[model samples]
Target: MNRLLRTVFLTLVGLFIVAPLIVILVASVSTDEVLSGLPSGFTTRWLSDALANDQFQVGFAYSIRVAAIATAWAVVLGTSAAYAIHRFDVPGKSLLRAVFIAPLSLPRVVAGFCFFVLYASLVPAAYGTVGGVAFAHVLLLLPFVVSLVGAGLANLDPELEEAARDLGATPWQAFLRVTLPRIRVSMIIAAVFGFLTSFDEVDLSVFLMPADTTTLPVAIFLRLQQNQDPVTSAVSSLMIVGSLALTGLVALAARRAGLFATRKERM
Candidate 1:
């Protein structure tokens, strides 16, 4: 009875949460002029218009470039730091970990504003450039890599790597042969999260992006300021659908990785 009740309650909550998304999805196809109430008729014109917008195209290209660069750098730096934190004892290890993980807790707007101020004061050229925005994204994504990969490392036994080392393997060989394989799932998860976060980030991009061109989310936001274009709704609907699809893919991947395994299955 309790399990059934819990399932019903969760279903209700999920539906409630997605109510706004459903409305937006409907609005994206609505032929209504006033956009006040329920959709009068269905059409795909808004979606096509949004897709054809030049600013959105430029913003998309920019988002992809920044997300790719940022995620790659964050994975490399964060994975190295995770390994170091797991393998050796060093001075200020706690502090180092804190610094990397701090961004996850800090509000994005505050962090973005701080970085913007620092850049404007110290390096004016970088204040509103693509490189600067990518750099900021890398910083924001570090915590996901560190936390996921560190958890993966912690679940591992040190004896496994030591055994490899004892069997005539060098340090690098032991890591590649034993440690790295075990943490690949964590690395993939981190990379996915880092990419998505960088791609969708708006608050930080708002302050750091160039005046001429910017990220897709920020572009959509600026356009909204001019008028409540139906195109924005269409763009939002696309984003909503994309988010759902990406989430489904991650869930499928996680299941294959045994993240959703039952305790009995794990045993």
Candidate 2:
């Protein structure tokens, strides 16, 4: 009975998570009256129209550029921060860790507003620039990379690094040869998640956006204010499909790296 209940619960949870995506995907292809019923007719025209839109094209390009820059910076800085927090006894270490992860503690709208005020007041040059959006995205992504990389560091056996040191490897060489290789999967996770977070960001990016240049998410949001366009559904469908594919790849990579051991494997 307990096993049956567990299976049922899991099925419910999975359905809850997937139902929305399924609805959106179906709506994307439906020619009309999705709110009334299932698709009356199937058409790929909406998808084609979204692609042909000049604003969406520009927004897509802009989002990619910003997300790339944000992910690169976040992974570099967050990895270094995680390493230092784990590997050293620096002063104010607890405070530093709190600061690094603090971004997640605030409501996203509040964070966005705070950044808006900061740039508007002191850093006028950065306001309404790609650099501004990228910087905010780094802050948003810092906690994810730091937490994941720190977990990876914790799972390492210290003796391996010590053995490398005993073999006369310099500290850098020992780290590169021993520690860095082990945490590679974690880094990949950080990059993938960070890129996705930056790309899909709307609430935060909206505040920092330039008048002329906007991210894809921001463009989608602005269009949403105007009307419920079929193009929106089609675009969302593409993003949903792409994101699922990317997540599957990440999961496969993690499993191969021994991060997702099966129950029998654990035994």
Candidate 3:
């Protein structure tokens, strides 16, 4: 009975998670039958229509650019901060750590509004441009990078770094040669998280994006209010597939880095 119950629970959980994605995939490939609440014979018309739209392509390009820039900045800053906080004894370390991660606790809208006011009121020109949007995205994703990198750093071996230094390597060299290689998985994970956070960001992007430039999420959101069509479903399906692929790649990297070797390693 217990085994049967467990099987049922797992089945339900799988169904719960997969049902929406299945619906989206089906709808994305369905013709007008999607609007009729039934499975239409599969057709690629929606995907073609979505791809033919210039707005979608432009928004996707802008989103990719912004995500790449924001992720790069976040990974650089976050990795440095994580190493400093974890591998050294810094003053106000606990407070600093909390401050680094505090942004994640607040609502995104609140964060967006704060940035909006500060940038618009204080630096109007900067706030109304691509640079401003990228800056805000970095700020929004920094905490994720910091937390993930810090966690990875905490689990790293201090002895390897010490040995490198004892062998006449400078502190910087020891870090770069020994510590960095070991903690690279964390950096990669942080970069992935930062990219996703920036890519899917709506609240911050919506406020920061000027009249001329808009990210994919904001553009799609604006369109959704006016039209709920299969084209939207096609775009959403693509996003879902892209996100899942990225996640799979990250997971593979983590596994190769011995991240999931055991429960203790995971912790």
Which 10-residue window of candidate 2 scores lowest in summed lDDT?
Answer: 30-39
What residue pairs are clashing in model 3?
none
lDDT of 3 by residue, 48-70 (tens): 98888888888899899889988
Compared with the true structure, all predictions reach lDDT values of 0.89, 0.89, 0.84
Tens-digit lDDT track for model 1 on 1-267?
999999999999999999898888888899974478878899999999989999988998898899999999999999999999988997899998998899888999998999899898998888767788999998899999999999999999999999998999999999998998788888888988888899899988899977578999899989988988688999989887886798789879888878767669989
TM-score of each: 0.89, 0.92, 0.90
Model 2: per-residue Cα lDDT at residue 259: 68
Determine the backbone clash count of candidate 2: 0
> How close to the true structure is residue 33 of candidate 3, measured as C-alpha lDDT?
39
The worst-scoring run of ten residues by lDDT in candidate 1 lies at 31-40
For model 2, residues 170-212, the per-residue Cα lDDT tens digits are: 9999999999978888898899999999999999998997746
Each model's total of backbone clashes: 0, 0, 0
The residue pairs in collision within model 1 are none
- Judged by whole-model lDDT over C-alpha atoms, candidate 3 comes out at 0.84
Candidates ranked by TM-score, best first? 2, 3, 1
